[model samples]
Target chain A: MAVEITVKGEVMTALLSGEIDHHSAAGMREKIDSAIDSNMPSLLVLDFGGVSFMDSSGIGLVMGRYRTLQKLGANLHITGASPQIEKVMKLAGMNRLATIN
Target chain B: MKIVNKFNMSLYARSANEGFARSCISAFASQLDPTLEELNDIKTAVSEAVTNCIVHAYKEKLGKIYITAEIIEGGILRIKIRDTGCGIENIELALTPLYTTVGGERAGLGFAVMQSFMDSIKVSSKVGKGTTVTMKKKISPRITVNG
Candidate 1:
């Protein structure tokens, strides 16, 4: 339904879990935004270790983060996407937007 | 936890059907602990395909949307999304990467995204009957970084 993120020192790590769809977008957007606003980490890392499903609403989440960091001047990185999730990113031009580690 | 069993939903195939189906996914599949990225992938793929049906098939006419999901053998999740709308006239041409019926010079990545995001994708449609999109995903045995 949503994702969880942990801030470790200067690096904020998000442990994204569960299915993401339109319904969950608002909550996710708020949570991630809060994490960014509260932690103000220099490096933001999204760990997809627990993820099981993703959808277009996922794009809005990623893109929203990318834009947010752009304005704040922070480094963003993504990791642990499933193969199917990874392909969607590639097709959506995610590679060009942020580093997919 | 395992799939337990397949879940199914049927509703009037309207634009709202997209949001309804999407909400159901988040509700039913959250237990697997999908990452934010993973959720995004499924959402994008499903949205594109369902949107295609609403846009191309019904052409504003009311129809029906049927969806079935199963945590198949090997811990894989399989989803069958179907609509009673106009069927694809040419499967080959429609499946062609970067091909679309509208908006030229576009990336034409809707179908491409569906195929790319799902481990296995299947489709069935007949003229005047409508179309069905089958999508599958296999969760990794081990939950490593960036699942």
Candidate 2:
């Protein structure tokens, strides 16, 4: 999996690609967490446009980041999710925690 | 009338192999010509089962994950994902949503996801032995109109 982060003022967007599974979740979490810590962004947007496949691990990745960002007084938003990815997120009830578009 | 097609594969229970195993099963099930949603559902369920083996079964060391896919009559797809590593002591608790034993790392939705995607699921495991997850989904035949 590949994750690229971009900072625009207080909003940090993480563009994720490849399949998001258990193995990739750890690395993606660390990368996003480090970015959140260093930048202290007011809003974090997870871009899932490039992600082809995702399982429950993706839900954990989003939930973990939401918790981390909440601690830093930041908001988490998810964008660019494919229909499949969005369904998984919805199934896991992640929509209740974060804004998905 | 009989089992139309079937395949059995074994791979190292590594996190990286989870995707590979999922693809293999999805491809094998493709013969039934499932829709994109159906295919994605099957793949996601397969990923969850294999992931359980990698994360929970062989926590400290790498082991093996066994997978079997078969298409019987009436376009029913049956998939079995098994691991010979440490099995679950409480299957009921394991099936509970958001009840993970691995302390904050897992979302505890593996079996739930599998259950949602497949038509039926049967889990049998023995503590200190292994776990076998069998899931079945019926694929409907696609229709084509004459031009």
Candidate 3:
């Protein structure tokens, strides 16, 4: 998977692409978490426009990040999730915790 | 149990191999001409089963994971994932949603996801021996046949 981060004012958007499974979750988490810790952006956007496939592991990734951002008093926004990916997130009850766009 | 088709293979229990295992199963299942949703469900179930072997069973140690898929009568796909590694001591606890031994490292939803996606699941294991997860899904035929 490829992850790209861009900062705009107080927002940091993480553009993630490719399949997300257990193999990539931990590494992806570290990369995204470190960026959030250092930048402390007010809003963190997880853009899934490029993501092609994602399994339940993706839910854990989103949940872990939500906690990290919450600790830093930052909000999480999920955007561009394909319909299939959106259903997985919703089934995992992620919509209750983060803003899905 | 009459099977029309079957495939089985074993691969190393490496994190990198999880995707490979799942895609392989998905492609093989495509022979049944399952709907896209059914294909996704099968892929997700395979992912969870193989991931369990890599993460909990072997804990990064080199091990072998076996996968067997069968196309039973009526387009029922049955997949069995086996691993010869450390087995779960408490099967009940492990299947509980939100219960994880690795703390925050995992979401503890692997079994839940498998159970959700597959029509039936049977798990057998012995401490220090290994664990075997068998999941079955009924593939809804997308094309109807008229005689």
**Evaluated with DockQ, which candidate comes out highest?**
2
State, as a TM-score between 0 and 1, how close model 2 is to the true structure. 0.98
Q: Candidate 1 — which residues are off by over 4 angstroms?
A: A1-89, A92-101, B1-3, B104-107, B143-147
Best by lDDT: 2
Residue B126, candidate 2: Cα error in Å is 0.5
Candidate 2, position B41, lDDT: 95
User: Each candidate's lDDT (Cα)?
Assistant: 0.72, 0.92, 0.89
Q: Per-residue lDDT for B18-38 in model 2, tens only?
A: 888988988898899999999
Those runs of model 2 whose alpha carbons end farther than 4 Å from true positions after fitting are none
TM-score of candidate 3 versus the correct structure, residues matched by position: 0.94
Q: How well is each residue in B1-147 modelled by candidate 1, as lDDT tens digits?
A: 465678888877565567667668656555555666556556666777776776677876977778887776566777788888989889878888657676412245667777876687888889899899998876656457885
**Judged by DockQ relative to the true structure, which candidate is superior, 1 or 2?**
2
Per-prediction DockQ scores?
0.12, 0.83, 0.67
In terms of lDDT, model 1 sits at 0.72
lDDT tens digits by residue: candidate 2, A22-97: 9888999989888988999999999998999999999999988888888988999999999889888888998999
Kindly list the per-residue Cα lDDT of model 3 for residues A61-93, writing each as its tens digit.
Answer: 999888888888989999999876786787678
Please give the distance, in angstroms, between residue B13's alpha carbon in candidate 1 and its true position after superposition. Answer: 2.6
